[model samples]
Target: MLTVRFARLLLLAALAVLPTLSHALACKEGGRNGNVLITEDIGTTVAVPVTENTGVPIWHSSQRTVNVHCYKDNNVREAEEVYFYPNPRPKQGQPQGVQFGVVYKGQAYYQTERIPTGFSIPQCPSNVSLDKCPAVSFTLSFQVEIATKKPYPGNGQVGINQFEVLQFDGKYGINNAPNSNLVYKVTGLDKIRFIQCAVKVWLNPPNNTLD
Candidate 1:
């Protein structure tokens, strides 16, 4: 009984300390600002944008995009590249340009062929309707990639083991943006049968200045 109690106490202590340690690590990984971690699990079909506390422009003014790659237990299997065009040509279609699909176990289970447009208005004039003044937005999608050879019974859901986010510099031309890439390594994927996923990214201020 004493040994069991001691183990229980240790477990409680570790659980209590884990959150603090995680926060510290996040800050450290992010440097002075710390890293912004986002996770999407089953049933979550929306992308949540990540905002900075320092109040600096994190995204390029004209070209804003996020590249997401899904991994199966650490190996990348599918990818999606979404582009947000603030002022896309009329009649061209939605401002969100998407290129990619969600694949699992070497088979594509979902694709973003007709996803809806995601947009938001930061500020609206007194007379202008908030919906009319669009400022920024993005879309999110999710799916389970199960092994095709031997499918599991029931939901057959295979949670996303890991994923990666590649935030490109919108200010610089696409050709040069690769040189200034900001990659966020995300882990601890949800274990639910189905996964909810959302992704939001912004460009960090250059030199921490408003330039």
Candidate 2:
């Protein structure tokens, strides 16, 4: 009977201490297990201008997208270059310049496609009605897979398991003003499964210009 009671006390002590140790392990800066989730911009859209002074041509003044690509093998790299080429067409009314060549760079596995969402209106004079001449907007959706590998005890080796973002817009901004980075977390495992990522990008037009 005395042994039984002693064993029960020891078990309780272990349970209490185990949690404390686990908490400490969880607090470590870089543990074996990590997280996997794609980050998206918080804002809805960023406005870009389609002007001559601008470095390149773009589809719309503001645009956003989520892209993805499926690979047959895992030997691919995370920083692989993905290009998005817009459909070609002559500039409306102006029969002068070429109208295409807006490529967005992203991971190699992701495909090239713009997933448009909506439009925006630049600040114009009060006398000007924005309904007819409102600035255009495009939106895209991003998707990333969740990590499947259990957190090991060191820097985890994670791949772009599966990811994509929808792209919106055709024209590029001057100096590439409207741009941001994708947010990601190494929260857990190396292999990830169905995770969702959403972000929006837009541009601010040139100080005084239009397309």
Candidate 3:
């Protein structure tokens, strides 16, 4: 009986010292407009301006930044490139020469046919934060140009909306080659799955514009 009581006390003491790790950035899926299911893993929507010229092709210009944090895991990396699921499809107008670019060297923008995410830790006004940046974050610039000279009918969200944000290998963000050294699995959420990755949105003008 003494051995049994002593063992129980030891187990209780060990349990008392166990660390309670909170899921820092694992948010529940199905985030509605302006609503974040979880607080830490806040989702966001980036707005782009599609200006229609009187004679020339419609011009779309936008630059913004995203913020991210990792409290429970370590060695997260920003992906070299992340692809958009369901492929970005324009609903209203046909966007010609539509391309997504990532700003590199703070001088030239690297264009990509796929989508990319940049985290700033706190929302920054510009694609590349002019102010101080967090330890693990960067900016982004997405530009769409050369569309038919037709102004959007009115104004509505016309960009990649509510797509699953996937993570690839890196020391800044999420990774797909889910290895152990730098892998970060969520507490109760799947980072790449639809359950925890509803982290992107692009709104369009109510006009006949393409995202």
Query: In candidate 1, where is summed lDDT lowest over 10 consecutive residues?
Result: 69-78
Candidate 1 per-residue lDDT, tens place, 40-156, comes to: 332333222222122222111112223222111111112222222121112322211111233222334223232222322133345654234322232233332211222222342
Clash count for each candidate, listed in order shown: 13, 46, 31
Error of 3 at 111 (Å): 4.8
Error of 3 at 29 (Å): 16
Runs of candidate 1 exceeding 4 Å displacement = 1-160, 170-179, 194-211
lDDT of 2 by residue, 51-143 (tens): 223223212212324332211111112212222322211121211121212223332222234322222223334564422222222233323
Better of 2 and 3 by lDDT: 3
Quote the lDDT for 141 in model 1.
35
How does model 3 score by TM-score?
A: 0.22
RMSD of each: 25.0, 25.6, 17.6
Model 1 root-mean-square deviation: 25.0
Per-model TM-score versus the true fold: 0.19, 0.19, 0.22
TM-score of 1: 0.19
